[model samples]
Target chain A: MMCYIYDGSFEGLLTAIYETYYRKEHPNKILSITDYEKSFLYKDVFIDTDPNKSDKVYNSIKTKISNQTLKHVFHAFVSENEDSGTWIYNYLRLGWKVGKKLDLHLTDDRVLAIHNITRKVSREIHYMQGLLRFRKIKNDVFYAPFEPQFNIVGLLASHFANRMSDQNWIIHDVKRDIGVLYNQEEWVITNINLKGDITFAEDEEFYQKLWKEYFKNIAIKNRINPKLQKSNMPMKYWKYLIEKN
Target chain B: MEILDKLKILADAAKYDVSCSSSGSSRKNKKGGLGNSHISGICHSWSDDGRCISLLKILFTNYCIYDCAYCVNRSSNDIPRAMFSPEEMVNLTVNFYRRNYIEGLFLSSAIYKSPSYTMELLLKTVKTLREKNFNGYIHLKAIPGADLNIMREAGKHVDRMSVNIELPSNNGLKLLAPQKSKEHIIKPMGLISSKIVENVSERKLYKNSDKFVPAGQSTQLIVGATPDKDLNILTLSESLYERFNLKRVYYSAYVPVSKHPNLPQISTPPLLREHRLYQADWLLRFYGFKSQELLDSKNPNFDIHFDPKCNWAIRNLHLFPVEINRADYEMLLRIPGIGIKSAKKIISARRVGPINYDNLKKIGAVLKRAKYFITCQGKYYGETKFNEDNIKNSLLANSSDKLNITQGEQLSLFSLYPNLLPLPDILTKITGEL
Candidate 1:
């Protein structure tokens, strides 16, 4: 049995997928660089990142399958699904057979798995866009910190850029140790490490206090259903919510 | 009083207005502007009732001249009242919006000095927000009997506007809210609709000059408030949709906020009935189901046990067991478990190949309900036979699976003598859908 190992990056995974199809060698398992543990039972294949090869495979998919299918693949890769590498490989192979209508093959297990993963990633992005609370940090910058289940910093930055064009903001992904900084013009994703001790603006807590007050006052006393609230907003996201606090 | 104290009083007073959706306009951010509206609106928070807090929904002031029987802020009720100065209101809206706490403002006001007085104040607040280039979505309520000219000017600055028809019929309005008449409420609705139509055609003729009520108008009807039946309310709503070209008609379950001799003695709101009405409203808007198709004058209320769609499908069983693989989109949408999303998915998914139960579940259909109404290639896997009573029992069994498995007190009851059942069970059945 052979296990395929690649650098833990979306581009590297796509390149590894290209190699599997190019060499026609199917591996028993696919693991990211950090995911693989030292084991002697299976032969290991290390895949190097090659933009040329990745672009070739990407172009083939764009030409053969519809662009919508390719977009779904990218979103699925950003998801935290551990089996997403092999799943993408199987999905692409199926896409090659089914052409642009590959998404309609919902009965197939591999296709359905990819579809669910993409949906999950997009849903997470949408939820974070709404649920995230930004505070006025120093330098007059609006700073918000979150721990999303997917790598959605870029998506959130693009959305805020469209919505708040004249403001400077930074959305940090605490789990990924990366953040997107938008300086009232453009946004760039950078590796960011933060010190826990940080001070907010002088009137920041006042606005937050008002917000918490508004949140509490708006709820109807008779219609309090904590169960339904939990269903709409999972408890995992409560840590960053100022109102919940 | 301080703004903080006023916020608490105003927010508490505004809780009964249930038009919470912010999904209408898709106004883009102007250059150097501070905000924009997404095509699909955003919800900044959720209240305890699992309802969205999209906009900073609050009344500008609770002081009113009319003593509406159902209003908590009626003149005779003696509730704590405060008013926000136009400056204070503008500051609050901008600060909250910049903090990402709300999409925009849903500013509603009571008749302070006069309808025209309230209208001018509303116009002042929204104009200030727009002059500051706050391009966020604004849904301002139009005060009935306001000058048509001022209301139309107000429409040009905001994204969406609404004139709530608080009651279904003219008699109900006259009895509960004496100052408000059906003509007074609908006049602004007709004005807004005509201006929206004019803007559409004007934009088509010329290039562009700022639009008027670009998201169109919507109204709210208080359910369970009067003796008016669902048939009357729905037919009224259908006509509003046809005549006014309204964007939406919100149904707010009547929560008894004030005491009056005419009001019901019940303590809690009829949330399930409201849910059924919303479901029926969705059928009217998206499924192309007419109000007459869902309910008739003879049967003025929806069934308590099943949703409007399920009840319709159960009565019209000859239309089904529709072949899942071959059903048209409209026919597929008529099934109980197949929503717009699932019906569209079924159509696209079947273009690739045939689908069965497993695929149906993955494609987001509620198979527990759909199985009784649909078949995959003419094969039915439902446990019960093709009888209405049996299917109803099976559906109930699915809902109360644990109760049935534990041999709990049987819930089976024939409608032949529905009035004879115990009062507790009858109440439970009425609120069962929730």
Candidate 2:
């Protein structure tokens, strides 16, 4: 009975998985250091994040099990679910035994657990890609502030980078206090804080007013269903949406 | 007029044209490009009426030369008119795209001077967006009777082009819209359809050949406007998909905005019927069901209680109780509750091991609807006996009444402003169908 703990970073989780294999210890639980609580039932082992070890495990999963399973692991890590660490650890344990045929075993509870979390993460990414409303701020930069359920700021960088290739933009995850900043050519994720005071560029309020007006008139007044609207764009996401606000 | 006033009148006028999808084109961003098109189409917002606002759907102008009885923008109607200059349209599209407020522009218009002249302005707007290195999705409405050379040239600049065949049947068209001949509408559709076919082969030969309507063509048909049956609409849509290779056919419920002698005087839009038609459309495109299979001369309308697939399955009870593990992919799709995603999951899961009743749910099968139609591991899980009436009753007992036909009628436009409605001749349009 061993409990493995690592830092909250994705690389740290992979390094923890590597330790379980190298030390030949069966993990009773795998958790991040932030999620760990004192328990007398098992001995805790703090696994330090080593890039070399993490890369080795990452490449092995891509080659041994399948590239798709590797993506599932990464997405599960990004989901930030409380039990995601344990689920990914168990899923990989089974995936290592079955090799490339692991994803076909959908009925397996561990595989299903990992698959479900990955779906949640990807679904949030897709939703945020659409729901993120950018406001023009100083310096002709497009700034969007959102509070997504999952840590998906990094995942959205490449998408917006390719879509808005000629403009400078910043996608801020307000809850996480991190942003993906994109120049004309490339993007990088870094810590940022707006402190809730954002100066709108000239004509920004005009366009926002126009958008709100368009939103109101575009709906078929004959078919006003708040339930359907709430289902598609939930109430929680209305905090930062320009039209909703 | 100010831009704000123009946007309001134009967007309000264009709301009835209900094709807002910005999908199917994967135009990549070139060097120094401002935007790119998403293949799956991203919806930026849902309007209060619960429809997706993907593209910035608006009309180039709301002025028309021909009067149509079913249209709000009929030349005879006393509505506010507005038009966007080519530069104004280009500015709105770029700013909206940059702000992530929309995927692209769904540019439609009422015919102003003439068809060819109107199309030329629409073409100029899209061309300016392209010249500015904007790679975002652009859906341009091809004015029917527009010159073929202008329409063909417009196709090369836009992602998709559509000429609305608003009325489903030619007879309906003649009676409701006297000016629009069926030939005038079909001619442009045929030209655009053939050019899209030509572009496919040309692209194969020269990779750099510009794509023509790369997202493919789509059209909208207003339901409940005329006395056209679901059979006529479905059959017409089937031919459009087969002949023109249309990517989609949108069905909008007729929202009564004008009092016309030929149009129906319904108090509310037939939302439930429109929903059922869309469901049936999905079946024809993806579920492999033909129009003739869903309806016959005896039954020209869908059941108000059951969906098209469930209704079909009940009438043909011999096809029920399909063995889940042994059923082919197409047969799995034929079952009431199994969809394309679930069918694919079943096939992939069966390769690993045989599926049972428990695994069917995790594979995404809706057991409440599928239980009566399938058997897992040779075991039946349905509550009722293996008969048509029993199965339908059991299914009905478990179903929710959310999509009741009588719903959505209480909140009518006439209900809000009682003084504005013409109530005396309401009986002139009720055939008691649908």
Candidate 3:
């Protein structure tokens, strides 16, 4: 049995995928370097990431299969699920045969696996877009820190970049120890380790107090349903919510 | 008063006006704008009532000149009064918006001094937001009896506008809110509708033309406040959708906040009835069901035991046993427990291959109720006979465990029956889809 392993970066995974197609080898598992364990039973192949090979694979997925399929593969890769690499490999192999009709084959198990993972990632992206609370910090930069289940800081930053075009902002995925730093012009995802307490700007407490007051008063006393509130805004997300605190 | 005290009073007063959606507008970010509106709305948080906290829903003021019997802020009731200056309101919106506490502002107001005066105040606040390049979603209230020119100008500055037709029936309006006339409310709605139509065509001719209420308009109707039946309300809603082309009609259950001779002396809000109305409203908008078909003179209210679609399907059993694969999208939508989402999935899945019972479930169809109404490849899955009574009993047995209603008790022959079933109170939480 052969096992393919690469660095956890998206481009490294794409490069490994290109090699599998080029070499015509069906590996048992495709894993990231961090997730890979040393095994004597299977021959391990460490893939070196080549930008040219990865770009070829990226363009082929876009031009041959579909743009949406590319999005699925990228999102599923970033989901950080252990089996996601194998799922994306199988999905793209099938997608290469079916072309743009790949998503329509929802009944196929290989397609369904990718579909479910992408859906989970996209759901987190949508939720983080709304639930992320930004605190005004020193130098007028709006800083929002969240511990989302999926590694979706890049997607969330893009959404906010368009919505808040004039302001400088940073969205930190605290769990992953990475963040997207956005100036007025553009955004870039980079490794960031934030420690200690963040100092908030002046009047931050005033607005937060007002928001808490509004959140408290807006609920009808007669229609208080804590169960419903918990379901919609689950306990996992309450750690950083200003109103929940 | 300080901003903290004023926010508490104004937000408490504004809680009853439940038009909670921040959707339908796609105002993009400008070169140097503070915010932009998403095409699909986002909910920031859910309150204790499980309602979406999409916007910073607050009233410009709690002071009112008119005394409406159903209102907490009515003049006769001496509630704590407060108001926000235009600059104060703008600052709160910008600061709240920057901190991601809200999508935008929902600036509603009680009739302070006069309708025109209140309308001008709303216009001023939104105009300042626009001037600051704040492109966030703004849902402004159009004060009835306000000057047309001011309201028209206000429409250009906000993403959406709404006028609450508080009572469904004109008689209910006259008896409870005597100060408000039917024409005063309807006139602004009519004007906004026409202006939206005008804006659409103008933008088509000139791409850079100014947008008027780009998210369109919506309205709220208070349920259980007056003796208005579901039929009247649904009919009014249908016409509002057809004639005015409004985006949505929100139904807020009367919470019994005030004491009045005209109001029902109920301790609790009629949440179940409100839930049924919302279900029926969904049928009208998406399921291709009509107001007349859902109810008539013979049956004016929904059955408390079953949802509207299930109740309608049981009443008309002849339409059941619909072939799952062969049925068109419209017929698929009429089946019980098959929502618009599931119906669309079935259609798309059919193109790939023939679907079985398992495939239907995987497609997100609620087969618990749909199993009775549909057939898979010429075989019916329902255990009971195809007759209305058998299927109805089976469905009752299925739902009675959840609702805690007595299983075998016969429904009363009288039309106006009490809410015997004690469904959970969370059922009244207004879903964001509406």
Give the best candidate by TM-score.
Answer: 3
Candidate 1 on A83-166: residue-level lDDT in tens?
888788889888998898898887788899899899999888878867888888888888888899989888788888887788
Which model is ahead, 1 or 3, in terms of lDDT?
A: 3
Off by over 4 Å in 2: B403-434
How much is the lDDT of residue B271 in candidate 1? 63
Q: In angstroms, give how far residue A121 of model 3 lies from its true place.
A: 1.3
Score every model by TM-score. Answer: 0.94, 0.95, 0.96
Docking model 3 quality class = high
Summarize candidate 3's per-residue lDDT along A1-245 as a digit string, tens digits: 99899899899999989999999998888999989999998899999999999999999999999999999999998899999998999999998997888887766789889988899899888777789999999889899989998888887877898888888999988888999999999999999988788888898888899999999999999889988888777789889899989
Question: How many residue pairs of model 3 clash at the backbone?
Answer: 0
Per model, the share of native interface contacts recovered reads 0.62, 0.77, 0.81
Instruction: Itemize residue pairs with steric clashes in candidate 1.
Output: none
Sort by lDDT, best first. 3, 2, 1
Give the DockQ (2 decimals) of all models. 0.60, 0.62, 0.81
TM-score of chain A of 1: 0.96
lDDT by residue for model 2 (A1-245), tens: 78899999999999999998999988978898888988999798999999999999999999999999988998999888879999999999999998999999988899999988898888788778788999999889999989998888999999999998888999999899999999898899999976658898998998999899999989888777777777777788899999998
**lDDT, model 3:** 0.88
Ranking, TM-score, top scorer first: 3, 2, 1
Off by over 4 Å in 3: A39-43, B405-423, B429-434
Models sorted by DockQ, best on top: 3, 2, 1
